[model samples]
Target: MSFDQYHEPVNELSDETRTFARMIVSLTEEAEAINWYEQRISVEKDKQAKAIMQNAQHEEFKHFGMDLEFLLRKKTVWRETLKAILFQNGDIVELGKEGEEASE
Candidate 1:
């Protein structure tokens, strides 16, 4: 989807929500950059750059999905609506704190 499709006027959102919206916009831009890198690697004849770009793109996609989830959860919507939107994908669990080890 185009950025224009998701773009809303700043005045439409409260100050705190506007901050979150800016983060979403920034993340979307980063995702697009990663996508462009992936395409570039696909066309380039170099093998090493292609592998690097592929890995980078995967990481970027993960971050993008996480950011989207974070922003959606912060919105003042019904519980059912939130569940419906994010259900069947996965729960938005947080990672362990710094220096903390995984329990599993």
Candidate 2:
């Protein structure tokens, strides 16, 4: 089997590092699926088909969120930064800037 996600030699990396790389790749794939569904839904002519795509997109969103939370749990700094940036409404860039400072 191909471990395309690994930039470093698989034998040289720790098990934890390998797992992290796998999850990172999983998260990227989920994000791409969500984007693909979005584009397909936009051009879809049938209302029923569009609704089905929307439902599938929601599943992808959940997968992406779960993957993100998993990664965040592993990286404390990222968790800290996103805790500041997520769930609040207002200038996102400003919040991110504040989060980057807060995480340090």
Candidate 3:
């Protein structure tokens, strides 16, 4: 397996950091899978194929959310920052600014 996830030497990183890297990779892969499904579903001729892709995409969404939650649990400031921005209706840029300030 390629160890491209580690910028630093893998031997130098702690176990927790390595685990975090793996999850980050997993999160990225899940996102990619979701995007691929979206594209495929959009052009699919068969309704059944589209529905199957949609179902698979939903699974990717769950995996992405789980990976994000795991990372957020490891980083308190990140969790606190996102709380101000996520699920809130407002100017997204303003909410992002508020999240940054709140995290600080």
Of 1 and 3, the candidate ahead on lDDT is 3
Winner by TM-score = 3
lDDT of 3 by residue, 4-96 (tens): 899998888999999999999999999999999999999999999999999999999999999999999999999999999999999999999
Query: How accurate locally, in lDDT, is each candidate?
Result: 0.64, 0.95, 0.95
Clashing pairs in 2: none
RMSD of 1: 10.2
TM-score of each: 0.56, 0.94, 0.97
Expressed as tens digits, the lDDT of each residue in 8-100 for candidate 1 is 765565787666767778677878977798788779888888788888888888878777667766764522344543444444442222112
Poorly placed runs, candidate 2 (over 4 Å): none
Winner by TM-score between candidate 2 and candidate 1? 2
Whichever of 1 and 2 has more lDDT, that candidate is 2
Q: Could you tell me which 10 consecutive residues in candidate 2 have the lowest summed lDDT?
A: 1-10
